[model samples]
Target chain A: MTRASISSPKPALVAAAAALSTICLALAPFVVREGDLRLMIEIFAVFTFAQSWNFLAGYVGLMSFGQQLFIGLGAYFVFLISGKAGINPFLLLPLSFVFCAAFAAVCAPFVFRLRDAYFAISIWVIAEVVRMFISQKDWLGSVSGLPLVATRGMDRTVVANTTFYFVAALALISVFGLYALSRSRMGLALAAVRDNEGSAAAVGINVWWTRFFGFVLGSGLAGIAGATYYMSVFHVEPGGAFDPNWMVIMLFIVIIGGVGTIEGPIIGTTIYFLFRAWFAGTGNLYLMLLGAAAVVTMLVAPKGIWGVLRSRLGFELFGTRRLGPTNHRSSP
Target chain B: MPPVLQADRLSRRFGQIVVADELSFSVDHGQCLGIIGPNGAGKTSVFNMLAGVIRAQSGHILLNGADVTTKAQHERTRLGIGRTYQVPQPFGQLTAFENVLTAASFGGGRRGQDAADHAASILDRTGLSKRSDMPAGALPLLDRKRLELARALALSPRLLLLDEIAGGLTEAEVNVLVDLIAAIKPTLAIVWIEHVTHAVSAVADNVVAINFGKKIAEGTPAAVMADAAVQEVYMGAVMDVAAVG
Candidate 1:
């Protein structure tokens, strides 16, 4: 019976889901309003950002305070390269991942020496430094910002639709990609490291490399999503692109939704978007309300909403658990 | 032939506390070395040194005659040093199968079906087959201890270090665990630090007793337990060697 579960029809379900998502992606541009499409693009990008951080904090046991560092860098990479090369911003999405990943790789050796909260703050410091550096550079539009030069003359509908498709693709990949990752050997390694470093090492896992891989992958995903977000806006500045607000949004979503479970962030992101939509008119009050929601969720459901729901409902979507064999034999 | 594992005059101290006082021992394949010591006598610390979790201040660890003192913990694990914690340290969120599977995959260097099969077999051997589906964190204390042993075996190590695996178990449970260890006793060299002396004597061919991080007795289990100095060390302890045997 347990063996049967390993060969379950999860593949068929995933294929069907992917097909439906692609179909929706194809049709949404035509059916959805321009403003709504813009909103959808931002929602997907923001969710992807939350999901990547969730992977790092929950899956890999690394809490990073400077996630905005990647966001700003990703946006900067897209705007700067597209402006100078006269290339479509959409064409440069993958490079944003490479650049952020490389930056993380270079930072890991030094940053890893500081553990837990210190490691988190070190990245934030790096983000602040990069933001200041970008703020001072005149040619890179330091203070002012740069526009998507390639998209300036393109048809408004064409640009929005294309951005939707690209951002939508990134969103789909983040979800399915995270699910697939959570089931792999590396996922088990990450879980082990997160649970206990001594046990992880005793079990022959290279704890350092496992964490480094997670950090790079999570940061790279954030970079890709950040680029997609800025591409939708058609402008990127040092302050807005590298804003600490990105960290706040991610933390609020992941914390209130669920810290570890993939489904938790999905639920959390939806709630966050709704809260924003409902409170959009209240200006700064919305941020305060978001904080209240998080505090209440913590008091009521410390594990997040999905975590509570999962315990009560026993519904599992992407958990990497393999239950024991059921006693299927008949008794006389 | 060189013993499967040999510790040569290992010494380690934490500030003013000496946890290992020039400790030296050897266990060859098919041999079991039962280490008995009072609490804070550095028994677990010795296991930690052997597993490379903690490096000794000055000593050499030889695995099959290869000096492994400078190797990283996981490197030592890959070189066939597997250990269980005094208090079971499992990947709590992972199922029992996953705890073993991770070790088989990374430590044992097995992959795919091989790792799975090995993990399953280890679970069966450790009498955790019925609980393999449950998360390690959710398991009862007895099963958690069994899971620790199962995870260590998953490494397929040449030298197995059992740290208080029999502690906090009923006599019946301890007997079952002893039976399991005895059945596989000849396949690997085992260094077991156990408070339950009878559980140690049941399978141990030889025994060493430590006091304040120094070896005070070494001989057959019966001989070491009868040692006057070992008895002296246990005078103020809650569990005495004579009562257990």
Candidate 2:
């Protein structure tokens, strides 16, 4: 609550809070049930996805509709390589990030030529192309999915706990890592570019390269989270892996939680899962309810649930506001 | 040394409307050149060309004797050319301090404590020290204008382009701005395009008048203001220029 204040908490207070959070996270796997552990892993993976997209939409001033591209590419990279090379898929998680980053770097020049919605839609088009290419490649699985080749008979609890650890690390990175990045020099550049590209250029920030860096970083984070996700299911296929619905869920979590704040995704992910638990059985109604919730949130508090909370509380949990209008709280 | 900035035979057109027509000028070190024209006379287009926001269809732009005609806008800024927009475009989400700090580090190429101190000095220099922590988007017009100037100065520019920075300020504020520019005038070259004629006349070492993108008059501020061609281009130039005070 004090973090919402203009004056950041003392360094000692910050360090203490960080230590506390680390202890709680380390203790969770020991006490949690296997089913609940799997659920928590999904929640963290989804939260990481939302956080990455939030970073893109808010700080980097990019709205990409093709985030699923990296998600599918990440899942496929681990699946195909692990099945053929017999290396543990978990061992290849870092490589998944590398593959996605390299892909984003290659696509940046072509996609960057378009601005706003066109730029966003071009990414979606690329994802579709790649999905189609993979669907036709027999070695890549065709229509049937590939199973986890190595570590198939590993202890169930061990596999679950290991996945939980990786997802937990990623979730923490999405929060603290993103906050630190936003406070860095490159963060200042990202904010300038987000607010106005013309002014950023005039100030000598290389607008293209700055945006390129953000795109690559966000894509890499999403890639790793996606790998952790599919690795748990032990199956990787084109249809579900590259599904645009993944983009929809990510967009929903970010927009409903607050597009830019790290804390927003946490609150949003909680609400999203609750809504899913209650409404998932409603078939198309579940999606419609999600759509309606988004519209209402946009209409009421365009900044999202966290935005409203921050405004009311007069403090931000993880305020790395590098772009948009700053809300002024009246001094008493 | 060669002139700090030189625009040789700059020409451009939008379809049939010529925005710049064989325009040529130079400003030596420590000089101020004022450009004045009617609302649509392409005064800003000239500044845009100089700032590399827009390229000239023909001719060359030289900074310190090197041709910079093909360079990008950010590259031009790094090479010691800094500019302000007609409408102040401060990074709204950032505090006034961060705005200038970004320019100091990126544009001025300073590092660490140097950049921080430089940013503080610029904010103080622009009379924005008290509002250093305030978000720039919430600042009033005068402060925003000052911030615009401060951000440009943070670039440690060899040449500064001022595009109507004084447009929306009050009489007192404009005078304050004039004083600030005059104090800094000895260190670098400046090309200022403004409709606030009196403000221009106060700080301009030299003046040029243009209409339809062609230079109609160029001489001492008083001499150019008194030119018949300039007077015709701006029938109100004499009365309006003298009346602002």
Candidate 3:
């Protein structure tokens, strides 16, 4: 009854690293410009969003392209309820998560019935449907969208500071949430399903139900990111609300970093930001560069940056808490 | 003891071909039943139907006298019906231990610590305790077969369905497997489809010969192998000398 134990340097070290990184980031406001800090907040939020997508696509093999549907819902719900309904935006953020998660749960049965490529396309279509529907709505600001007409509980300066703090908090939570999920039994189920659905069933795991749960949980995380983003931006238009570009950006982050690992998205997002800053003045060139980079990454380093680091140097920026390909090897 | 598995008038057809035509059989508790057939005999198809991988067009399968004809594959597994594929398809990304652990958790319905213990025990029983940390996909042919058996054992099945478990092994490997299976025979009923006659004869209490999906002969392994109809069915198909050796 002795289970095989792969070498792991305690979860405490990983937790410490996460805490240290968070503290360093929280104190970043003193040395950094407001613009750079804003970008960092955006990147952290976006990194979480991307990692959520990766959890479904990479680990569970859900391959959902309609994650923006929940993202837009997260952004729009917080905008409407807090900005227009005149509620304390920060307090209302959890509500957005509930709403978005509920929406994903309701839609899961229908969308999950479609297998592989069709499932991916169905999510995309659903997001577009939501976007088009919002574009035609009157109270929610049709094509032009709506702005936060009134500020509730705080002035502009305080709101900016609070919003940055909220973004940083949510990002940390996202990392922890992903860490917890990947380490748990659910994460093991997802990896099994991703590897072989038939074998998973033979082992008595309900593949469809596990995948649906992962999809919903991931969408809930995206919903949290969307809510925090809405508070900072203070606006929601249909075009901006359900941005297709956001999906591509998230996908890129995960692929560049490492698909199924926690640090993959973080590393990918950091590299993406550096590139984005360098190429911002070149207009469409940034998109082209990223596209080319993605193609090259897929061809050359299909495992991505974390994959390379792990294989070459036995590196783990985030603690090893989950079952993955690495867990299969017998070490000396 | 009551029959561990009973298939009542299981019938299925594919256009003009009847794969399982009113096939009825029962395996008693702690019995080992070996199924033999020439190529295209639908032996695997029968295992598939019993495991709930493929639904029978008509008829019912009862485990412990409870009908489970309409249950899903995972449901059947949860009900303690574990099976191994002929090709040995273990989860490629998982270590041999994890593969068995998943089976322990889901099929055996054990919780956290209990599941791990069950998985480790299953691995040990299958002679895979040493190679537990190796990825299933990376294991050698014999080890892969061991892992497949270990995975099924993890479910702690009341009835284990094995499809061609010894089809691709050396004679020495087959002997090793036969001994392993012999040791586990007292615990559960097993229905194994095999081309290797020695492995089947070594462990099975009963043998059934199938052709075109119907039972051609059924009795003790020696008696069934000696049946004229069974001989005609496997004539020139399998060398008798090679099987005995």
Which regions of candidate 3 are displaced past 4 Å? A1-7, A25-33, A150-153, A319-332, B241-245
RMSD values, in order shown: 2.6, 3.7, 2.8
Order candidates by TM-score, high to low: 1, 2, 3
Model 3 CAPRI quality:
medium
Model 3 C-alpha lDDT per residue in residues A1-332, reported as the tens digit of each score: 35544324456766887889788877877777888877877887888788779888877788887788888898888878876667877777788888888999999989878988899889889999999998998977898987765455467766777778877877787677677666667777887898888888888989878877888888888887887886677777889768889888988898998898887888999999999989999999899999999888988899998889888987675654322222434432
lDDT of 1 at A108: 96
Which of the two candidates, 1 or 2, achieves a greater TM-score against the reference? 1
lDDT of 1 by residue, B82-172 (tens): 9999888999988888898889889999876677777877887788877776779999999999998999999999999999899999989
Q: Candidate 2, residues B38-69: lDDT per residue as tens digits?
A: 98999989999998888999999999999999
Model 2 C-alpha RMSD vs. true structure (Å) is 3.7
* Winning candidate number (DockQ): 1
- Model 2 stretches astray by more than 4 angstroms: A1-12, A321-332, B236-245
Q: Each candidate: what lDDT?
A: 0.87, 0.87, 0.82
Q: Of the candidates shown, which would achieve the greatest TM-score relative to the real structure?
A: 1
**Clashes by residue pair, model 3:** none
| Candidate 2 CA-lDDT value | 0.87
